[model samples]
Target: MRVQVVIIGSGPSGLLLGQLLGKAGIDTVILDRSSRAHILSRVRAGVLEEGTVHLADAAGVGARLKAEGLPHDGFSLAFDGRDHRIDLLDLTQGKRVMVYGQTELTRDLIEAREAESRLMIYEATNVMPQGFDSGTPHVTYEKDGVTHRIDCDFIAGCDGFHGASRKAVPDDAIRTFEKVYPFGWLGILAEVPPVDHELIYANHPRGFALCSMRSLTRSRYYIQCALDEQIEAWSDDRFWDELRRRLPAHHAEAMVTGPSFEKSIAPLRSFVAEPMRFGRLFLVGDAAHIVPPTGAKGLNLAASDVHYLASGLIEHYEDRSNAGIDGYSHKALARVWKAVRFSWWMTSMLHRFPGTGAFDQKIQEAELDYLTHSRAAETVLAENYVGLPY
Candidate 1:
């Protein structure tokens, strides 16, 4: 295979990058080791910040999104049986988020690519990126016991946290910053309407409960638990009982109980590797950084990276300037750090303390109370939650 850009992984980042590049007349090829198109259909993130919505439209993949995505002006924060709404649109001057799943977004991008000439390689192997200055980078992969090499002008590593691309970088050049939280999210996908008009993030002695959604008929929810929690230990009845205690509403049991499609422990962590570019290869999305899911910033962050990547690549092509490539790392990190802080804040405020004195929980509640009651405090939360300018 020969192309201008070779993107690894067909997840949101890789697929979206491919769509953007393809629309730009850049011959891009996406290679994924997974043999089948993703149909997991489980809901993940529903909140989209204003800046992200604008960028998504500019990238050309936002056409169907604007039409089908459910728009929300704000979301609510709940604690002590009280619900407080943070009006994002009012705070951000017309900025609003959408309720959509990462999976559907991925599917949209892939469907858009159908008319384009990009290659989608599955059951791929070998998968090593080689050569740079020679003007052609090598991507070796094997399929059905047959080995093949893909040549491209630049390679994009978007496979994500566990992919092989990160390891391909020379050890001497990689500088990593990471934080592994003591807790993990026990996420569940249930067939039920949302518990509230807006998403509710609740703090309880049991743990943190996020009231999120996939659409009008399905709910995407999560509760905090020890990182080592096992799914086998949580029976269906036990799951409903826990949810009832965490979520506050009439018929709380009905709000939680329904046909569930997924229940898994998603580890919460924040990580970033410096200098996202090496030779002719660029790492975007999860290959470059990861944030805890509390802020619903994962897909947004991934999209932002590609937005800059697309911009940088365009500038480099139009002006014959290395400015885009040179500043890529610096520009990407500014956004990364802001997201990490927001995720950390939400995580700490909602989850239970392991051994902290009562003073700590009281302090958290105080902080929460201030944010919910004070316009200035909500302005801060609204700014971060609605997104940090991109």
Candidate 2:
């Protein structure tokens, strides 16, 4: 088979890229090792920046998001037994975030693609990108014991951290930077109302906790844990108790407890791969960068990557220019680094290090205090949280 572009992932980044390209009359074939059900079943971050919302709308997948996504103008930063609300709308001049699950967004994109009769190959084995660095790039994979090859003009590696896209690049050609946090986030999803209308990020004496939601009736909560913490060790009741202990008295008192339907422990890390473009192959989303969930930048970063890559590809085809493609890596990396710094800052401020001394605790407290009282500091946080321009 031959197409203009072959996308090696069905995640939000890949799907969104395909959607944008399709709208521009460019043909793309998406390939993934996982089944459609598995892709949709994976739980991911829910926060959406304004730029991401606009991209979704442009992709024609925002109808459901517009009707159902929760719009939050501010979120609470709870510390020292009280809540300090950072008015995101006011601080960022009326910009806000949308609370829509990544799973739903993927489904929306997939459905839209299917409606347009686009090609998507799922559950393909040994999917690999071949000759991306040479002229006439193509992809190869095995499906149902049959090997297949696809010739394409370009390849997009959106298959995430463990996928074959980055691995295909020569070690000497790509540079990577990574920082793994000493802790992980033990999170749970329950069918219960959220503790507050807006999200709450708490820095407690015990640990860091976050109260987020997927919708009005579904709550997503997290608390910092040791890197070696086991999911099997946490029960619903125990998880609730520990979470309550980490929040202010008011939130704890009003919190509703229930049996959790989904639970897991995810290690926190910030990772980036330099020179996102390798010849005809471009790394997008997790394939290029990763951020800690503290700042809610993970999915938004992926969307921004898609934005840059899609714009470049559209320009390459429509205007017959390679300028946008040539500048993709530099432009995307600039925004990527700023978010990395913000996520690192948020993680450092909120999380408790394993061997910190009394001075460290005091510094963290002083930093939070300053952030709450100083409008200048609040504006910085608000701007980064809502996402920088694409």
| TM-score attained by model 1 | 0.94
lDDT of 1 at 96: 75
Model 1 residue runs over 4 Å out of place are 39-43, 133-136, 249-256
Residue 204 Cα positional deviation in candidate 1, in Å, after optimal superposition: 1.1
How much does each candidate deviate from the true structure in C-alpha RMSD? 1.9, 0.6
1-390 in candidate 1: lDDT tens per residue?
Answer: 688888988887788778777767778888888765443343456577666667667656788778877898998777766667789889877777888777777777677776564578876887888885356688898889998898877888998888878889988988999988888888888887877657888887677888888777788778888877899998767877787788666526447367677888888888988888888888888898888888888888888888888778767766888788778777888998888888888888888858856787778778889888888888888888777764
Model 2, C-alpha of 94: deviation from truth (Å): 0.7
Highest-lDDT candidate: 2
After the best TM-score superposition of candidate 1, give how far the Cα of residue 25 lies from its true spot, in angstroms. 1.1
Scanning candidate 2 in windows of ten residues, the lowest lDDT window is: 356-365
User: Clashes in model 1: which pairs?
Assistant: none
Give the range of the ten consecutive residues with the poorest summed lDDT in model 1.
Answer: 35-44
Candidate 1 overall Cα lDDT vs. reference? Answer: 0.79
Cα lDDT for residue 158, model 2? Answer: 97
